[model samples]
Target: MISVYHYMTIAAILFAMGTYGVLTRKNAIVIFMCIELMLNSVNLTFIALSRHLNNMDGQIFVFFVMTVAAAEAAVGLALMISFFRNRESIDVEEIDLLKW
Candidate 1:
């Protein structure tokens, strides 16, 4: 049987990879994907705990997280599309929109 440690370790690795991608990637879409990866990693932890405790609370929380993730993906993709349309490029370094 798989232990909690195994699940947790997998979650940790996924979260780390997502973090690294967010920090190193310049494309907005890639960063968005990484954010989703991080969210999924958290969901994995929640599921692991839920199974270990034989409770529904963790699974319920995962449901909520999934809902939020869906909303975030929709809004993030729309924003990226709008930005790309205006800038004609999606490169993070060149598409600075905060300048005066």
Candidate 2:
């Protein structure tokens, strides 16, 4: 059986990688993927705890979080498409059109 500490370590690593990608990537799609990675890391932690505690609450919460994340992806992608159409670029630096 896998240990809780090991699971936590894996989650931590995934979260850190996601954070780094989000901070360093310039493409909106890549940033979205990083956000999903972070969310999945949290879900992994929740699933691990739920199994360890023999409880359903954590898994249920993860389901809700996944639903929200899906909605967020749809909306965010739509916005990114709109921005790309208007600006002809998806680079984060070129997003300065929003700045006044």
Candidate 3:
């Protein structure tokens, strides 16, 4: 039986890696992937807690989060496509054009 602590540790590591990728990567796509990783880490934690507590609420919340993530990914990818068509590059720094 996997312990909750183990699940939490793995989640923490994954979230940390995602955070690092978001902070240090210059590519917009990579940052998006990192954000997905972070979301997945949270999902893992949710599922683990749901099982440990013998409750369906955490699992239900995870389902909602996944749904939102899918929607966000769709919209985000559409925006990325538009940005790429206009700029010809997916570098995060290049997006400074929107900076005030």
Candidate 4:
């Protein structure tokens, strides 16, 4: 039977993959996606624990996390679009506009 441990394992794997992607990738979009993945993994964990504990708070927290993730994604995409337009590239290493 599937249990909270299974869900937690999946969440852990997803979080690790996201972390690796964030650390190794240079593209702004990929990094953005990795951040989303990490957020999702956390959501999974929250839901799993909520279910295991028969409590509502974790699920409610997941709702808040999702809302924040959505906002973050919208803002991140906007920033990426603006940066791409300005620099003609999305490579993180190539971005120097922020350097004073």
Model 4 is weakest, by summed lDDT over 10 consecutive residues, at 91-100
Query: What lDDT does the true structure give each of the candidates?
Result: 0.94, 0.94, 0.95, 0.94
Per-model TM against the reference: 0.93, 0.94, 0.95, 0.93
Candidate 1 lDDT, 14-70, residue by residue in tens: 999999999999998898889999999999999999999999999999999999999
Worst 10 residues of 2 by lDDT: 91-100
Candidate with the larger TM-score of 3 and 4: 3
What would the per-residue lDDT of candidate 2 be over residues 6-31, giving only the tens digit for each residue?
88899999999999999999998999
- List CA RMSD, all candidates: 1.3, 1.2, 1.1, 1.5
lDDT: which candidate is best?
3
Give the per-residue lDDT digits (tens) of candidate 4, residues 27-75: 9899989989999999999999999999999999999999999998898
Scored against the true structure, residue 92 in model 3 reaches a CA lDDT of 89
- Candidate 4 stretches with Cα past 4 Å from truth are 97-100
TM accuracy, model 2: 0.94
